[model samples]
Target chain A: MAALNYIRSNEKKLKVIKSNSITFDNDTKPMAQHQLQPENWVDLYADYLFNYAIGRISDSEVAKDLVQETFMAGLKSAKNYKGDAAERTWLIAILKRKVIDYYRKINSNKGKAEVRMNYSAQSDAEGDWLEEQVADPFSSFENSNIENEELGLAIQDCISKLPKKQALVFTMKTIQGISTEDICNELDINPSNLWVMIHRARTALMDCLNQNWF
Target chain B: MISCEKAAIICNKAQYREATFIEKLKLRFHLLMCKTCSKATKKNTQLTSLCDKANLHSLTENDKLKMKEILQEKD
Candidate 1:
């Protein structure tokens, strides 16, 4: 009788799995593509986009403004979204343009041109060609900055590849440094479950970084 | 005498500084006997340092809320 009951439960579980796969298959169909949830944009992509911006620009206030502008542009261009790329990817493409616009605005500003001319003039009485040709002593610092940005992008890419729950937990615990208890409360998970998720995330991240980074 | 699985759990906990004193001692003993786990621990430490070096920053809560407000207003 116990063995019969076990078989019944196994059948029930299989039915659930089969039905879930059916929905998953349907979701993957070309006609039924992924939908955007604009309301959840801030909760989902804000931090990731902010980090991407700040790493490139290294200015907190401008990064925040650019993130806001990206969302605004995303909303305006919602109809053009093909749903072929993931929502975050689409948003990132917008943010990239926003960042470029920011750089162009600053570079083309009248005040910035005056500042640049003043800097070159202060370097030497003669033409600034020699000053421009000489290698910067602090070039190593710039190189390290580029290296850190690349490393940061690699890590973010790996985190994005994780399951959504695992990514959220890992980011909260490791990157954001939120208290474990707080994460548990927010995610409605127990400590042990959190640890298991963390373990899985760390192991997967290590393997990914080994392949792509190390 | 702890299993490798147990040692790995302890090692992860140690990374967060959440392992108890006894758990850490047991992990140390396990690492001493287990070459594979010791190598893994080293890689895990390297991962931690790399994360630190990356210095990735996130948006503050208020900033995120402001962004949401802007989106809502436009929408």
Candidate 2:
């Protein structure tokens, strides 16, 4: 049936909704999450926006707010959504904006000194030995088999603990899903230097995750 | 003339997928004969995805309510 086709194709969002536990903020209730129509905003996009926030802020509390803010905004703008993308994707886009806005606002209000590193993908392999830079040998791994703790969190911790430059490069490449060239431009590092830093970041993260995640 | 050490550097960026094509071919050719670099590449990658696979945190009920309140504040 058409419904079955939709369900199977949209399984990722469906899985999120089915597994989601909806929550609301206490500040000014959008009063929209409480809307009792068949569509529960929280269940539908909770994990997506929540994950988006966590990825951006890396702080649990702030990430939580970002999700809530996203939902509130989505609720108001739901009519404009138009089902062009998955609900989760739409909500995530909104959350990304909120995160950027948070940084912009905080920067102005605090007026504190901060080193703003612009990440860029303007890079190319230095030369030969690119095989080392090719596919990650372990890309085919089944991480689901090892279940000590969330490897992602453990890795993020290790990444955060890395040298500032290494961490920034690693974060941009992995988390922001940006390119190395862009990261180099953002950090103003040469390709060779970028490779070295990335190596350090990887080694540290690999060790951290291997020891801790398992 | 990628020495084993330089090979290691290239191998490192490869894990991050920052390597170029010919560099990969060179590294691969070396890896075909160099056991040490091959093992290093394997171990390095095993570690990278382990961390990359880590899931981002999710929101809770209290924060959702707070967000609602924030939005409604202006309304």
Candidate 3:
């Protein structure tokens, strides 16, 4: 615990393991450590971010892009990596916003098909959950409790079906164990609105699981 | 409406084992008077437990590699 008390000109002071071999870091710059080792950020937080991206973008490629984008953006602004929160939470907060940005961009693409995904019916997010033609894969859950196996599949499927934004909210709050406030900051939603979206997502997913998984 | 929402709330909380005495009371009272709500509540509880026990994540190897590359890539 005995070390040199280094006072960062950034005004935050913490312990430093001082040595005679210390070379003066010429840069009066901030966030040098994180910027120099961006890979370490992902090495530490990639699984968390990747799961989140899958829930939101639903495409491995796009999710990859978003995670990369989140990391790149954070690196460029490492000055903002203030130690006020856990670095994982802070990095994830960045990724959540990235997900919302993707959702908003896609929600406006006029030429895209109006789609309802059935996670149980197909692996792709746009596999079409039309009322006709497709033979609803999860219809078997209606008025019946699940026997086994099917129940588990149904839950996974319902989570997959959740829309990008709502799913992000629900996943961060429930799946990844991020705080709702962090979710709100990342998603740019108010507390009540976030709750409603989360509730609706949960309700819909629960209904889907009830009808399909159980 | 009250019966369904009340039961849903109680049932939802009960799923997390966070239902208050009054929540239990509402669910019980509603169940005593309405068979449909009672059935729905029972199913909700059962289904919620099933969900809590289910493994929602099933990431593939590609998923992990993509994640690793994302994390390790220089910002």
Question: iRMS of every model, one decimal?
Answer: 1.9, 7.3, 7.0
Of 1 and 2, which scores higher on TM-score?
1
Estimate how well candidate 1 is docked, as a DockQ score: 0.58
Number of backbone collisions per candidate, in order?
Answer: 0, 34, 3
Q: What lDDT is reached at residue A49 by model 3?
A: 64
lDDT for A6 (candidate 2): 45
In model 1 chain A, the worst 10-residue window by lDDT is: A115-124
The lowest-lDDT stretch of 10 consecutive residues in candidate 2 chain A is A21-30
lDDT of 1 by residue, A1-214 (tens): 5466457557656866987787677767898676789998887788778889997798899998999888888899899987866798899999999999998898896777664335454555576576777888654676567668778877887887889789888888888899889989988999889988988999999999887765
* Fnat computed for model 3: 0.23
Give the TM-scores of the predictions, in the order they appear: 0.69, 0.44, 0.37
Q: What is the TM-score of chain A alone in each candidate?
A: 0.61, 0.37, 0.36
| Per-residue C-alpha lDDT of model 3 across residues A57-174, encoded as one tens digit per residue | 6587788778778777877777766554456657778888998888878778765736766556656545445644566655545313222333444454576577867766665665
DockQ (Cα-based) for each candidate: 0.58, 0.24, 0.15
Best by DockQ: 1
Predicted structure 3: clash tally = 3
Which residue runs of candidate 2 sit more than 4 Å off their true CA positions? A1-149, B55-75
**Whose lDDT is higher: candidate 1's or candidate 2's?**
1
How far in Å is the alpha carbon of B36 misplaced in model 3?
Answer: 2.9
Local accuracy of candidate 2 as per-residue lDDT tens digits, A1-214 = 5455346447645645654533323213444332322145554455445654665676877777677766677767766755434455566688889999988877885546466553324445354555655767454343342321334444545655677567667666666667777777877888878777777777777677655444
